[model samples]
Target: MIPKLAILRRSGLLTLALGVFFLYQSLKLELGSWNEPGPGLWPLLLSLLVLTASFVLLIGNSEGGAGSEKKPFAALLRDSRLPLAAIASLVLFIVLSRYAGLTLAGGIMLLAWLRLLGKEKWTTSIVVAAGLTALCHVLFAVALQVPLPEDWLLALWSAGR
Candidate 1:
């Protein structure tokens, strides 16, 4: 079993790779001027943010850091809970988005992380998740005119109309 710090380093590396992939994918799409942002602009910015964050994580937890020492098996297991939860949540988000759409999936994931992982109050978690989801919707779908994964709820509503 890998030590906690090694796991963190590997995760950082994985994130860095993902960031690079996203950046490349985003660059394939048209990147319009700032005043007239294209569909790819938001994704480009997000990918850049991911790259920056992953680099920070990698540098902060480098081999020489205090957390680099090998920990006991039990301690390593305990320390891995957060990272496992994050990975699980990411999987959940991907699967859920395919069925429920990005807005709902994002909201659910955020709520779970904030409430269960972060130990935040239910009300606070719900509010923050909802707010963030709404903000994302407005920014991506409304303002930037980016096409998101088809939303089941919206489809149902449209069918009903």
Candidate 2:
């Protein structure tokens, strides 16, 4: 129980520290009006909420029982593979998007990630990847009229049309 409380304390402290850091960054940005919230507003509020939650956890742990058993930190770290994989996939998507354009890159990234990291079925991965690509195309290219990257492969396809 003591070990558990200690772990909780450490995690809470880390969260609180991150919250403070974000709060400081947010303070540097202009917080817009209530109706027209600026980019910093959401981050500021979220950091505050995180800080408050951390504080609550820290305080609660101080008087805790039956949570003293310490779990191995190595085990905790090892169990974080899925999150790390997801982050890696996002990084890969960003890098690939520059060369392959949004739709093709996104589709390939989603399919590979879902199939490999998520261990999803091939059919499911294909369907999901295709759906996500189409949805993103509609949202960014059609609806928002945002200009995504134009790869030579897609250009050739367009030229043939």
Candidate 3:
């Protein structure tokens, strides 16, 4: 294994360790039978999946590659737009949802993420945003019958209705 690729193995080992730690932590939560999954089930499964992937990444080929040095954390973050956009989206989503209601806030946030941050085509962004909004509606409003916030828009909507 090239020395550079060894970084990947070490990094993967760290991630695998963290995944294992989370998996262990998740075990403390209730793990219901397969027929009735408890809170721990999803986290445990996800952690196990992460553990598997990290292990694979750690051991995978180093033959065809230049074992490049890892970028500095600051440099990595400076080069990436997604993290900042995601954080902004969260803050904007919360504030927008407070006034606009879930549907509008969610739609706008998804649009911003897809179009601006993700650099998706307009048609694709719009479709994805609409689909996700509809999916959220179905999940929370229709299927689960969960009561959403009576934000300004929702209040006005109910008042008019």
Candidate 4:
């Protein structure tokens, strides 16, 4: 059986791979000039952040949550439904974002993560999700002048105007 620590390490490795992929994709886009930033700037920065975090996770000290008990990896995989679901939710968020703006997708994703994964109260989850979504819009769309994907609802509204 694989030790819990090993599983954690493996997860870190997986994260690292994902981070690398993001970085690579970001590199393909134009990393615009400052003041008149290009679309790629945000993605590039975000991907680098992911890379850094994943690297830290990979090398970080062993934590208490992952038990020291030696168990088969299969068992670990079988017992990781929540983690798996979280991952799936992330994929959903991405797909949703492609059609719906980040505000909507991010709100839904944040709400799910907070309420389901964090097991927070629904009111708390809703409040946080709304606040965070607004904050994200202000940061990315307003402050940074980054264009986010147009959600169907927003697109429809604009078309009607």
The TM-scores of all predictions, comma-separated, are 0.60, 0.52, 0.52, 0.64
lDDT of each: 0.82, 0.74, 0.74, 0.75
Model 4 residue 128 CA deviation in Å: 3.3
Q: Which stretches of candidate 2 lie over 4 Å from their true place?
A: 1-79
Lowest lDDT sum, 10 consecutive residues, model 1, at: 71-80
| Predicted candidate 4 versus true structure: per-residue lDDT over 1-161, tens digit per residue | 97656766776677678778988988888887888788788888877877786666555624545555433443434333455567789899989888776778899999999998888999999999999988887888789998766667556756999
* Cα misplacement distance, residue 20 of candidate 3 (Å): 1.3
The lDDT, on a scale of 0 to 1, for candidate 2 is 0.74
Name the top lDDT candidate.
1
The positional error of residue 154 in candidate 1, measured at the CA in angstroms, is 7.2
Model 1 per-residue lDDT tens digits across residues 31-122? 89899999899889988988997887677666665556643332433454675587689889989999899988999999999998888999
Q: Write the per-residue lDDT of candidate 2 for residues 120-159, one digit (tens) a residue.
A: 9999999999999888878987899987778655577679
> What is the lDDT, from 0 to 100, of the residue 130 in candidate 1?
93
Candidate 4 lDDT score at position 52 = 83
Question: What range of 10 consecutive residues in model 4 has the weakest lDDT sum?
Answer: 71-80
User: Model 3 segments beyond 4 Å from truth?
Assistant: 1-7, 62-119, 144-161
Question: What C-alpha lDDT does candidate 3 achieve relative to the native structure?
Answer: 0.74
Q: Which of the predicted structures, 1 or 3, would earn the higher TM-score when compared with the native?
A: 1
